[model samples]
Target: MRIKVSLYARRGEVLDYNHCYELAREIRRAIKTVDPEILSDEASRLYTFSRIMVKNRSFELCRDGMKLLTSQLYFFFSSLSKNICDSLIDGFVELRRLNAGGISFEVSKIEVIKESKITGNEKLVTLSPINFRDRSCEDADFEEKFTEKLTKELIRRYTIIYGSNFDGDVRFKVLKCKSVAIRVGGKKYRAHLMVFNAHGSKKLIEIGYKSGFGTMTDCGFGMVKKAKRI
Candidate 1:
């Protein structure tokens, strides 16, 4: 299931680019309010059960801070189960405030764009800048190790969510990876904007679409979306 939400800030309000974590927090808060049990377990909390995206209307830099000028924001949520999707939809409706950086907005509208299962042998995935790290050994080959780590992480997440072992070989090739910086909790971290081709089980790929890729998905990192062929 996939849902698109349109949000409108209260009059005279603005937002910042670094509000990704704040937006994710509001999403989780809303989901927990509707169905607290969804996050009761460690596995559930870690499971990439849903993926999100926040689209700003426009952006600007100012002395006060970076400002998002447009009143409207769009959010996309994707998952396998319609029930989970429905819960999120209801949660947004019941939400009192969509606050980010102390700024609040109202849910102007919500729409379900895709509710059915997504199936495809190959997919083009674009990842929101990912923080790929190797804390064990700083001397290791970063790119090679990062690729291996991400592959394992995806398989592990898929197994946990589906409750079935996916033995199929999951293959990924980074078509593009460029260094980028992201801010969270007032600290900046080096990350990468990656575009890749994934060839494997369609089900597994779809799971990544909803759950996110790499790590810190809940905090708005590693968000994945299908890319169109040019």
Candidate 2:
């Protein structure tokens, strides 16, 4: 399931560039408040079953800093749990104040992506930027390492969610990767916006879609959506 949230801020609100981490924390807080069990130590050890993405964000340059315009936030879940979904929606709506990178905003709208609207084919997928490591690796070795790491992560998350290990042929080749720097929780990390060709089961692909592809997904790092073509 996918959930989209609309946020609005007053004019002249300054927001830092790397605010996804903070935004993710707020979302988690809302989920935890509604049901603390979701964040228990045991659960923490398990694979993250959700992913977050920011959309329609706009920033303005100012002498002081960059100012941000209101935008939409997306959340993807692996399971269709009513309790989890309801808690997220209710908690977020009740707690209207949200702060991202120290900038405050109001939650204006919350909408669920129904089955009809959820479009994606799991077999062939395209991931947005996936922050796999904190520092850069050899350009030649990056693709191999990325594919291995992602395959392992998918297996882990698949076991946690489905109660079985996936033993399928997982293969990928990097179509393109653009080097970039990402700041989250006041720390900077080297990352990439990579397009890859993945050959895997539908379940594994779905896991990547819902739970994110690489590391730091919970901090909003590796969220992915279906791409018709790379």
Candidate 3:
């Protein structure tokens, strides 16, 4: 399931570009309120979130960060588990305030985003980007390695969630991509923002859509949405 969270941020509030770490912390706090057990188990967090989608005006970058000339900020959150989504909604509604990287926001609305059916072949665009390599690693055949690792991870996560093996083959082709850097937990890492096509088991694709692709999804990486066209 996916949800669009609408937040009201007053003008003059600044948002750091690398605010994913802070946002993840606050989101976990909200989830902990409704489902403490989920937070306790690291394996239980099969979820990811998109970058803050700003609206209503423009912004100027300053020494501090992206200063808000806007009043509304939105983001999408998705989970493979319905229980997690339900708890997140309830927790956010109860608290109604969110603070990330020293920027304060009031929860304006939370709406469920209806998911479209996956027909086993889909064009996807990343909402938060994807990363699966160690910061020190370099390879000449990085793209091949990326596909191999993604397939293995998808099957692994599928097994964990459904408690069954996925014998179907998984395939991914990057139509276009660009390298990007993000900071998580105060550490910088390389990631990719891309448009890609994934074809294979519908369940596997659904898992990627609902949870995420690649690694560090729990820290707000690898959230994707189906694109009508690239």
Candidate 4:
């Protein structure tokens, strides 16, 4: 399940460039608000989110960061568990106010995004960059490691959700990719923003679609959308 959250803020509010961590922290705070137990449950943390998107090219670049010329921005969040999504919605509604990167905003609305049908083969594009553990794009074995890590992570998530081992094969091929640098906890990490083909078990693909790909998804990495064919 997924939801789009719209936030309204005053114009001229400036957001820092390294706002992902703050954004993620605010999301966790919301989740904790409604269901404190969810924070303690490891399985409940299997989720991903997109970067903050300014509406209508409403922001301009400045020395500090993006200066909001408009009053609204939004982001998408997804998870395999309906309980998590429900908790998030309730949390957001109850909290009302959100603070990210030193900027304050009000939660104006929340809407559920309909799921797409998953097949054995699907083209996916990242909404948030994909991060493989201890791997960067510059590594000679990056692609190989990416596939290996992705497969194991999906199976791990499956086991946690189903309480059984996943015996299916997982296949991913990057069609187009580029490196992205991001900071979390004052440490810089290299990730990838890419369009890729995912081919394997439909259940696994669906899991990846809902929960996201690669590692550190809960920290807002590897969120993906079904790619449209041109």
Candidate 5:
């Protein structure tokens, strides 16, 4: 559990800064409460007005440690998001410094990430409705049926993918899908699932389906290609 934090705050203007190592110590203490089992690498970083450059460094840390931070805090363990944790640490440290209240990590950036990508395993698989049935609507929806079996199969595949890789991952902390650009049969495919996939890469779909929600419009067979594992 290694996190390197750097902050830029005004001194008398709006800045109540403290020693760099001391700030790191406060962060270390706060993290211990968050997770005692953390294998922390470094300490808190309070970069005062003279050291505003630390912001860039903090951003890089956000990226490097994002995976671990998210896995331990957010989606997997339901602990907290990086922003939230940073905010908490900031507040805790600030309050102690001024014996006052209110402080924040205005912004942070994460640089570089590590993950496993299996290119050979990326293959196109087709699923279809085994049984044809009349499509029905849910009152608000227009009805047109193709194959219920196909829907079930898609759902099953979705469950297999999402249920397996997503909800069950103990090492994952955060799972945010930003945007996705997909095409089926040389046509652009726009949907929520695609959007999510666009946000984060392999993190959202390690060994599972991209979208847990079986999309009704997710038609046609397509190839599943993956990047080489790093």
Candidate 6:
């Protein structure tokens, strides 16, 4: 079966879509410019995907609606000033805040994600190493020795990719699946393995960290499971 991929905008049969689509495009651009730092730092904001999605569909007639919706959404960063970077950070923080506050779904399990790819420098790292010590017919003249060297390169390359954000055309899978969470100060935290309903596409994510202490992932969802929402 062939898959059809078309970017969706508020076009086609939708009238008065220019404003909505323009807003939507801008929001997406802003998010793309902000999420990397926001995700890595694990911050919090006073926003929600529903709100963002709504604003992205803003209109002149619905101007009041947009403002009302956004007003409830706080800039969950350190301050209320709006910048592209700040907006993304705030959005990221807000998403986590809801998830931690029992304002979202109750995820009972997750699968740790893994990604591995051999390209560029990593490919060089996976090559046959230059024999140095003794160029004899015993130590460096066997297929096993070559295989071992290749394996070592593969390990090093994977290690670097896992830690750094240098993923180039790399794909992911469930890596040694587990059902546990992590903690930093005194709260519980875990990354979400987000799977969209469309095609079951997934990405390992750690959205929430902590609450009342300015977005963090240290606090687990178990603490905010409705029974503790106050």
| Best prediction by TM-score | 4
Q: Model 5, residue 19: displacement in angstroms?
A: 1.2
lDDT of 5: 0.26
**lDDT scores for all predictions?**
0.64, 0.61, 0.83, 0.87, 0.26, 0.23
Number of colliding residue pairs in model 2: 0
User: Pairing residues by index, what is the TM-score of model 1?
Assistant: 0.78
Query: lDDT per residue, candidate 4, 105-128, as tens digits?
Result: 899999998988889999999989
lDDT of 5 by residue, 1-230 (tens): 11223333332222122222232344445445545545232112111111122322322233212111110110000011343344445544543331101233322322212222422123221111111123222222211122223334443443543454323211111112222233333444332211111112233333222222223212311112222333
Model 4 lDDT at residue 139? 75
Runs off by more than 4 Å, candidate 5: 1-18, 37-107, 111-230
In each prediction, how many residue pairs overlap at the backbone (N, C-alpha, C within less than 3 A)? Answer: 3, 0, 0, 0, 23, 17
Tens digits of per-residue lDDT, candidate 6, 1-230, equal 00111122232222221222232233334444545454343222211221112224432334222222221211111111134334544443343222221122112211211223212211111001122121222333433433333233333333433453422221222111122233323443432211111111111111110111112211211101101112
Tell me the TM-score of each prediction against the true structure: 0.78, 0.78, 0.91, 0.93, 0.18, 0.16
Compute the lDDT of residue 148 as modeled in candidate 2. Answer: 80
- List ranges where model 6 is wrong by over 4 Å: 1-29, 45-47, 51-85, 88-230
Candidate 5 has its poorest 10 consecutive residues by lDDT at 71-80
Residues 1-230, candidate 1, lDDT per residue (tens digit)? 66777877643454555666777778778777877888675455552322222354365666544465566666666555566667777888898458765567778898988533446544455445666754322334554676577777777887777777777545676676766566777787666667777776676666667766677766666756666668
Q: Is candidate 3 or candidate 4 better by lDDT?
A: 4
lDDT of 3 by residue, 67-173 (tens): 88888888899997787888889999999998885688899999998987777999999999798654312455666777788888888888888788989866888
Could you tell me how far off, in angstroms, the CA of residue 225 lies in candidate 1 after the best superposition? 1.8
Q: Residues 159-181, candidate 2, lDDT per residue (tens digit)?
A: 77777877864677776667767
Error of 6 at 138 (Å): 76
